[model samples]
Structures are given as C-alpha cells and as structure tokens.
Target chain A: MTLDTRTTVRARTATITLTGDVDAASASVLDEAIAAAAVSSPRRLVLDLNAVDYLSSAGLRCLVFAHQRLGRGVEIVLAGAHPDVAETVRLAGFDRVATIEDQVGG
Target chain B: MTAHRLVVDGLGAPSRLVAGFVSALAACAGLPPRQAYRLRLATDEITTNIAVHGYRDRGGPVDLRGRVEPEVVRVCIEDEAPPFDPTGHDPAPRVAAGPTAVLGGYGLFLALRSVDHFAYVHVGGRNRTTLCVLRCAAGG
Candidate 1:
C-alpha cells in the first residue's frame, strides 16, 4: 500500500497518523512530518499507528529522531499500534523512551 | 534443528513487513523482549540499508535466514546489492544541546548496542550480515 501521513493540531498537541508500511522507502515522508511537527513545537505529539500495519527499524529511527529533536517536556504518545508493530517498538526499549498505549484504534 | 527463511523485495511500502515477521519469530523462540527488539532493530537497519542504498534504487530481493536454537538465535541476511558491512560504519555523532543536533542519524549506533554479536562480509557479490542473540536466563 502507498504510505500516507497526516498531521493535525489540537490545542497544544500535534497528532500525526501514518498508514501503510513505514520502512526505508517511506521514512522520508515521515521525516517531513517530523520536521513540520518540530516547527509547531507542540507540547504533545501523538503518533497514530493503527493503520500502520508495518513499522521498520528505519521507522523506529524516525520515531527516535522525533523523540530526540523534541527534547524534554514534549510528550510523544503512540496510539493504535498493531500487535507486532507495538511489540517491535516495546522491544526496542522505546516504551521507556515514550508513552505507548496498549490499545489500538484511538 | 530447523531453519526459517523469509524473502522480501524492496517494493510497495517498505521492508518492515519482513522485520515484523522476524521479530515475532524471535519472540516465540523465547528471546528476551529487549533482545528481541534489538534483533528486529538490527534486521530493519541492515535490510533497509540494502533496499535503499544497496541496489542504487534497483533493488531486487533479500533473503532472511533465521536459525533459532535452544540457547541462542542466529540471523543471516543475504542480499545481492552492494558490499556494505554494517559493522564498518562509523559511530553516530553525539547529539548536543541545541538546534544543531538533529534527531536522525543513529541507526547503526543503535544496532551495535542492540546485539551481543555482529559480523558482516561481502561474499559472492552479496552483502551477508549475521547477527546473534543469547537467550537470557530467568531473573538474570
């Protein structure tokens, strides 16, 4: 499937929803969203990964990049991650780095 | 004594599908959560590198070979792309406090820390990367 990325701002939060597979090929698209989100400097960043059936390490790099660039005080919430995808993130020790919701479709 | 193989191409979406599958396999084999995550992470980094930079945009297919033992799991990734050694890559630059420190550019660094063993080589005009993980004992 083709990759899709959409960003919306609610209050001081920015929600970026991703669909399709986020791998090396699609990381650039994510990079753009991350850059755009950085500009807003939202207090909270919510990554909606319900539609993201797949998340690669490259994808994880983007998330980490987001986490690093956002710095302290900014909260990154990952919502609606696929079972395997969520497990991948958790295994990467990302759960410790950010907030990971156990449930999907939020 | 069984070996599992997964073959993927650099087409449509990305190769994370391959990583997710391998991650599940590693978990089922009783690898620790952190270790499993690292395995998945390393697999993603090397495979994606081959897909993105290996074929010079003319990617073909990559072979993922997994051998899960009682005490350890071994992964051998073979690709016909460039002869890139993941181990030989330079360390990631430290991120300093300021706008100059970007968020990206730490893939190899993370991979290095995620696994206990790493070896890469160029063989038969393909990039072969081998990674191993030791099963952690309970409460250790």
Candidate 2:
C-alpha cells in the first residue's frame, strides 16, 4: 500500500494529511512524518486520515509512538478517520491518548 | 454456506490480499458496511500478527478460510509456525501514564474487540485463529 503524507504548520498546530493504506510496511513513512512535524514542537498535531482506506495494528503503533514522542503537552488530533480506522483507534484505546474528530476543520 | 480459501505469503504485503478477499466475502454474504469493515479489520490484525510474530517476517504460507452464514461471518486463519494463542492474552493497559508504558499487544486486543467471537487452537503443528462477526440490520 502507498502512503503519502503532507505537513503544514500554521501557528502552533501542525496538520499532517495522509492518503493511502497504513499497514506494517507503510507505517514507517508516517513515523517519519510525525517526527518531522514534532521537530517544530507544535503545540497541537492534527492527522488527517480521511483518505486512509485501511489502518492496521502496526499503523496504530505509529500513533502511539507519536503520542509518546510529542509528550503530554502537545495535543494530538486524528481527523477524518474512516469508519474502520476509527473503530481500530477506539478499540486500541487511542481515544484516551489523543482527540478524534470527524473532520479536519469540523 | 460456501467456504472460500486463500493462501498468501506471510512476510509480504497481506493487507491488500486480505482486503480483497474479505470484501468479496462480505459482499457475497450481504454484510453491511460496518460488518464488512469489522471483518476486514479483524482479518488484517490476525494476518499481521502471523506475519510479524509467527513468521518473524521471514515469509510463510498463511491459509485463510471464510464463510458467510445467515447471522454471522466466520473466518479462520491457519499458519504453520510456532504455536501462540492470542485469545488468552490480555490487552495493553488502556491508560499509559508516560512514554515508558509498553505499547505492544494492542494488535490482538483490537482484533479481539472487533470480532463478535474469537477463538484459538493449535492442531497438527498449525496455529489457527477463528473469528466471527455478527451481521446487523442497521448497517452499523
């Protein structure tokens, strides 16, 4: 699966837009993106997964890694997650570590 | 109920194969969107586990068998690797206070939570996991 990530920082928030499937092989790309976004020390991180069709456990680990890397002060938001991805996030208890939104701006 | 089987390389990208197979099965079974998604999620988790944990990503043959019944869709994944039962394992703690908290085990945990029924067995040097998801009318 292909994973494309684009990051834009506005103010203290970094928005990372991801498209394609996030599985074991492709999770590293997301990790690098999260690391890059964390470098600016943005107070908030928004991951847009509206276009991500599939998310696996390996992908979820990348989110956990992001939460750990950004620390507690940084608010991590998962936006526009597909239904399956949302369910996996919830089941993995990611909701406790980060905020989940229906859309990026919504 | 008709059963379908698929064998894929455990070390390669199994997600696409799993998605296609599960999507077809879900469609043939008339599963709603939500149920179909759950099946796909559960299958992905188990297959990934087999590839990562069981085969250590070295590549092995993983067999998947699935069937759609009237009320539930059932799937079984079999791998001829070391015997490991995920059903008996507990999920990672929901609350991690710090970065040091262990992040492993969520794969099986999410797989368990996503399926309506989950079971594990070892027979003839094969590790088999069976998962079932109930079909709902509301499509959720």
Candidate 3:
C-alpha cells in the first residue's frame, strides 16, 4: 500500500521510479513525484512502473493530470509495466497520451 | 461456494485493504488471474468513489462480501455514503487522437466495462454495487 517514489533528472529527461502498489491511498505519492518532475520541465518524463504490482484508476488519473500539468511539449513515457499493469494503462486510455514500453531506457 | 467478507471504515484510506481482501478471496476461490483482476478492479472503483466522492473528506463504513457461485464469482459492495449510482453513463475521453481527453469519470466506466455483469442500487440510504465475472466452462 506504500508507494516509493524516486525522481532523477538527467540530460533533460526526468525519470520517476515507483516501487509499490498504486491504489487510492498510495497514488498521492506518485502525484507528488510527478509534480517534482514537472518543476524541472524535462523534455522527456519517464515513469518506471516495473516494480508496481497493482495500479488502480486513482493512479491512472494521477498520470492523466501529470500529463496535462507537464504540458504537451514534454514527452511522457511509461516504462517497464507488467503485462497486467500495461493492460490497465491501455484500459484507461492512457496509451493515447503516453508511450507504454515493456523495457526501460530502451 | 466459498465466501469471504471484509468491512472497512472509509473515513480513512480504505481502498488498499479492500482491494487486498478481494484479491485474496479470488485466490481462495481458484479464480483465474484475468477474472480475478476484473472483479477486483470493479470492486475497488465503486468503493473508492464512495469513500472519496460520496463521503468526500469525511465518510462512513463500507461492507464487502465476495462469494463464488456455481457459474461466476461475485463481489457486493455496500456503502453508507450518500446515494449515488456508479453505473451512470459518462463520455470517456476519445482514444483516437488529441491530448484534450480527461480521465475524470473514467474510473467507474472502465470498472463497468471490465466486469461481465454489474448492477447498482440505492436502498434505504445505502448504495450497493455488485460486480460479477463469468467463470469459463473449465471453471475459471
């Protein structure tokens, strides 16, 4: 239920790594991490979801807000989502705004 | 015919526990991963809406009952939050193109779409949402 969020900015790219279940209680962590990433205005925002096991709609809504808050100029990429979680991303229409890749840093 | 029950005080963060309880029940019922996922999602979405929106910053209790029937697995979520049906239609964001699409009201919609059968009813100042997943012929 606890979501560990880490943000690293390098070479005009911001990578926010999340390691935990992303449910209603835990999604605020992701929201804050995305907020921190947006401050730097990175050209690319990569969310590393490889360690997350469950992603509820709350998390997806956070990503939608993050996408809007970061503006259209920033490229959003969701990296290393498990097949089930990836399917969730596709389920909420997140794939329309962000590139969901199976591999990170690829 | 395995049955499980969980009750959470939605005044605080209740979604994680509710979701975990459903997941464990699904495993106990021998539900397939896909069917289990859908039921969990539908249950989580409706209750979350109750806790977060219906009750707003303050709320009441939520009761969850999960049971495995002969042909399907079902979860009934009952909440004391103000009356509101989650099955109402919402125009979801268009996936075809444009970044203008918003995720608001999309949760309940996706929740309904994921489950095989869903029903919502308001009875005696309580809202109940039932979600069910059809078991495959081989018993998924």
- Leading candidate by lDDT: 2
Sort candidate 3 into its docking category: medium
Q: Write the per-residue lDDT of candidate 3 for residues A1-106, one digit (tens) a residue.
A: 6899889999999999999988888888888889888899899999998898788888888877787889888889999998778888887667888999887787
lDDT of 1 at A19: 84
> Given candidate 2, what's the lDDT at residue A68?
85
Q: Which ranges in model 3 have alpha carbons more than 4 Å from their true place? A: B91-100, B137-140
lDDT of model 2, residue B75: 94
Model 2 spans > 4 angstroms off: B92-100, B137-139
Report fnat for all candidates as fractions from 0 to 1.
Answer: 0.27, 0.55, 0.55
Q: Pick out the ten consecutive residues of candidate 1 chain B with the lowest summed lDDT.
A: B95-104
Tens digit of per-residue lDDT, candidate 1, span B2-102: 57788887544345576666776776687766567667767777676666677655767888889888787888989887577777763444422321244
RMSD of 2: 2.3
Q: By summed lDDT, which 10 consecutive residues of candidate 3 chain A come out lowest?
A: A84-93
Poorest 10 consecutive residues by lDDT, candidate 3 chain B: B91-100
- Calculate the i-RMS of every candidate, to one decimal place: 5.9, 3.1, 2.6
The CAPRI classification for model 2 reads as: medium
Choose 1 or 2, whichever is better by lDDT. 2
DockQ of each: 0.26, 0.54, 0.54
Candidates ranked, most accurate by DockQ first? 3, 2, 1
